[model samples]
Target chain A: MGDLFTDTIVISVLAATIRIATPLILAALGELIAERAGILNLGVEGTMLMAAFAAFIGAYATGSTLMALLLAVLAGMAMSFIMVFMAATLKVEQVVTGLALNLLAAGMSLYLYKAFFAVEGQAMPTVAVMPVAPIPFLSEIPYIGPILFTQKVLTYVALLMVPVVWFFLYRTKYGLEIRCLGENPKAIDTKGMSVSLRQYGAVMAGGALCGLAGAFVTIGSSARFVPDITNGRGWLALVIVIAANWRPSGILIAALVFAFLDALQLQIQGIGVQMPYQIFLALPYVLAIVLMVLKSRRGRSEEPARLGVPYFRGER
Target chain B: MGLRLEPRLAPSARWQAVSVAVALLAALAVSALLLESAGTDVGVAFAAILDGAFGGLRTTAKTLAKATPMILTGLAITVAFRAKVWNIGAEGQLFAGAMASYWLYTLTGPALGMALLPLLFAAGFVGGGLYGGLAGWLRSAFRVNEVLTTVMLNYVILYLLSFLLVGPWRDQSSFYQQSERIDRAAWLPDLWAPGKLHLGFLVAILAAVAIHVVMNRSWFGYEVKAVGLNARAARFKGINVERTAVAVMVLSGGLAGLAGMIQVFGVNHRLESDISLGFGFTGIIIAVLAMLRPGWVVFVAILFGGFENGGIKMQVATGAPSAIVSAIEAITLLFFLTAAALTRFRIVWRST
Candidate 1:
């Protein structure tokens, strides 16, 4: 226990925390936008899975990390269109549609992976990881720089996206419109704006970010794609968005905390702790529920007023 | 000339059936594209799936055995969904029930003999009900969103199951991450000799019928449907919305729990991590496809069960991935959902 708190160990844990949180932050930020716009796209998990598989296939085929990322983003956007059509146009139940999409994505990804990469007893093929782009002088700075400055280009972008999303949501006019859409799409419709169009844009952006998040799991962390690679990261992002009270800054903190627990689990396993690893694995989810319950009890519901409600132009 | 959509006052039963057919056809079309891309002949692959699902008595038994849990879970979803309670933790509830029954059977099977079987079912129902009722309580008491809570509970329960499998309840004799097989007297009686078919399938059918009666004929069912259709109105009419919500969830959960126990006693005969492969999640699809009708749920579950059992054969015959069945199920649900929405509005041709 004493040796576990060593400086090197501390820095490595912090680094792992950041590395693990990168995908959540990216996906949460996207979810932040959609949630703000009042569309609960529960299909984030499915979208990410689809994108992750697509990214892996692209990277495996082209050996170019950039191309792989591009394909992932496109795949995510494509999946999001389904949500837009279902929840936005068809006025279907957002939760069920999202669940359906998740199932579709999960099954499709496994099918595609098996069709393209099934080799009996052979390890999954690997792809070239995105090269780390460490800021030269900043990376040299002791604890902070090594942990923050030295990461893959995607990680840096994901970090940078926090502020970018914050600015877009709070500062920009279009961002204001998106927020208004969530709280009161009727008001937006009264303003002669196309509520569906704004929702489409928000969900598409969220989808792309989730796709990038998925790609990072395969390319930024692991070198190969695996089945259900996103695991429950997308779901975690949904919880983070809610726990954060729909605030961008809050999402950053929630993602980091969840990631810290994730990293801690791995470290404890490394230290050969006697406790079952499943307990540690289950910690983050349990904590999220506790946090959500507490947040809800506080009587300050920050949920979008129109969240999960379909917009039909003339419906009362 | 232009086409327009006119909002319908109410959806007709004929249109509802037609929509389902259209959704299935559309899903099949999409599957054909996927199969072709995967290098499997679509016709041959589907034929293989069909043959595998209904080829002979043996295969038909397998399909019914597979459908048992699905039918039970689907009824669980149907009950909760009809009442407007989104109990998405059916999968977790199933596991909780299985864990409860397994623990009870292991504890009392030797000492209590055949009496332990009913006790196992009761324990499973109680375990699953309590687990589900927790979420329902949170939602009704604290206004917590059941969607997130249910989904979160799923992971938590899954981890708990994993922990038990690896730690205390692990089979000591076998290296597998499973528990010791239940006592012979604790096992569900077999319905067919030389086959795995058991009385659990009959139980599923009976459960569906019971659910149908409860949903359509009972006052409790009336309250549930009332709350689902309009909670505020139901409350104004002096219905205890909170109590109804909690009761519906418990019932739904109990059904799901019973499914888990049945799978254990009727099929696996031991607790294992992979005892269920998303039966709870598939229940959602089944419930939706059946339009939340218990009787329809039975037919749909059987259809899905055939697909599930046949998927293995399709995989072996055409070398197509078995996951395609899952994809097809999802696609069909999506199409059905879209068509359901379409029923609310009529397609009309108009001159511009």
Candidate 2:
């Protein structure tokens, strides 16, 4: 137990916490944008899976990390277009559409992976992972530097996205329109702005970000892609979006907290704790539920009123 | 010319059938493209799937056996969905039921003899019902979104199952993470010799029929449908909305639990973490495909069951991944949804 609290272990855990939160932070920020625009893209999980596979394939084939990331973003955007068509244009039930898209993504990813990548009796393919780039003077600091200043470029981008997304959602004119679209699409339509177009923009942006998150899971963290590699991170991002109450800053906090729990679980396992590791693994989910319940008990959630409702022109 | 969508007063049943057929053809066409991209001969692959699903009595039995749990879960989802309750935690409830039934069977099977079977089913149902009821209660009391809670609970339940399989329930004789097999007396007897098909299939069919009657004929079913259509309207009609929601959830959970129990006793004979293979999730697709109709759920479940069994054969025959079937299912669902939407709004070209 005493060994668990060592300085080295503490620093490593903190670093791991941030590292673990990177993909979630990226995904949640994207979800934040979409949800703010009154669109619930439950297809995030499927989108992530598809992007992850695309990125892995790109990286494996080209040996260029940039190419891989680009492919992932494109894959994510392409998948989001489907959601945009269904949720925004066709006016299908968002929940079921999202669920179906998830199944589609899962199946497509597995099929593509096996078809293109799998070679019998060979080890899983690996790539030259994205290199970690530490900030110049900040890296020289004792403990804080290693934990904060040193990370992959993608991690820094994810961190930077919090403030960027916050500004975009709260400060910009377009952001105001997006928020209003969620609360009342009729108002946006009355204003002579295209509700579906704005929604399409938000969903595409969100999808690209989720794709980046998926890419990070493979290229930013692990080298090789495994089947279902994103593995519920997309769902976790959805939970974080809700838990954060749709605030960009709140998303960062929630992601970090969830990541901290995950990191703690890893550390506990490292310390050779007698208890089963699955308990620690399940802690974050349990905590998320409790937090949601507690938050709900306070009052009605600040969920967008028109969220998940399809808008039709001239509909009473 | 501009495209205009005119709202239909009421979509005809004939139109609904035509739309579904169109959607199915589109899905198949898209699936063929996917198969081509995967480098498999689409015709050969589909033929293999057909052969695998219905080539002989053995394969047909395998498909039915696979369909048993799906039919049960489909009925469960149909019940909950009819009440407008999105009980996505059927997966978790299923694990809970299987665990409870397995625990009961291991404890009382030797002493209770044949009576243990009934007890196991009851235990499984009660276990799942309680788990699902928790979500319903939370939703009713706090207006919590059942979707999020149920999805979260799935992971929690999965971990709990993992803990049991790895810790207390671990069979010492095997290296695999699975519980000890129950006594022979506790096993669900097979209906046919030389085949794995068991009484569970019949039980599922009977349950589906019973649910159909209850859904279509019973007062409770009417109340549930009323609540689903409009809670405020149902409240004005003197129906207890919250109570119905909770009751629906319980029944849904119980049915899902039965699916788990059947899988354990009739197929696995031991509690393993991977026993379900996402049967609970697939049940959602089946229920939706059936358009929330109880009778249609049986047919849809069989269709999906064929896909599951056929997928493996397709994989073996063409070296194409069985995941294509899942992709196909999703495509079908997307098309079905679009078709449903089309039924409400007919396209018209207006000259500007």
Q: Write the per-residue lDDT of candidate 2 for residues A1-316, one digit (tens) a residue.
A: 6764587898999999999999999999888888888888888888888888888889999999999999999999999999988898778888888888888888778777777777678887788888889999998799999999888899999999999999988899999999998998899999888898999999999999999999999888888878888877888898898888888988999999999999999998988989888888888878877878887778557688887888888889
Model 2 spans > 4 angstroms off: A1-5
Candidate number of the best DockQ:
1
lDDT at residue B216 of model 2 (Cα atoms): 89
Q: What TM-score against the true fold does each predicted structure earn?
A: 0.97, 0.97
> Where is model 1 more than 4 Å wrong at Cα?
A1-5, B1-4, B12-14, B347-352
lDDT of 1 at B306: 92
- lDDT of model 1 at position B202: 91
Enumerate the candidates' DockQ scores in order: 0.80, 0.76
Candidate 2, CAPRI quality class derived from DockQ:
medium
Error of 2 at A219 (Å): 1.3
User: Clashes in model 1: which pairs?
Assistant: none
| TM-score between predicted and true chain B, model 2 | 0.97
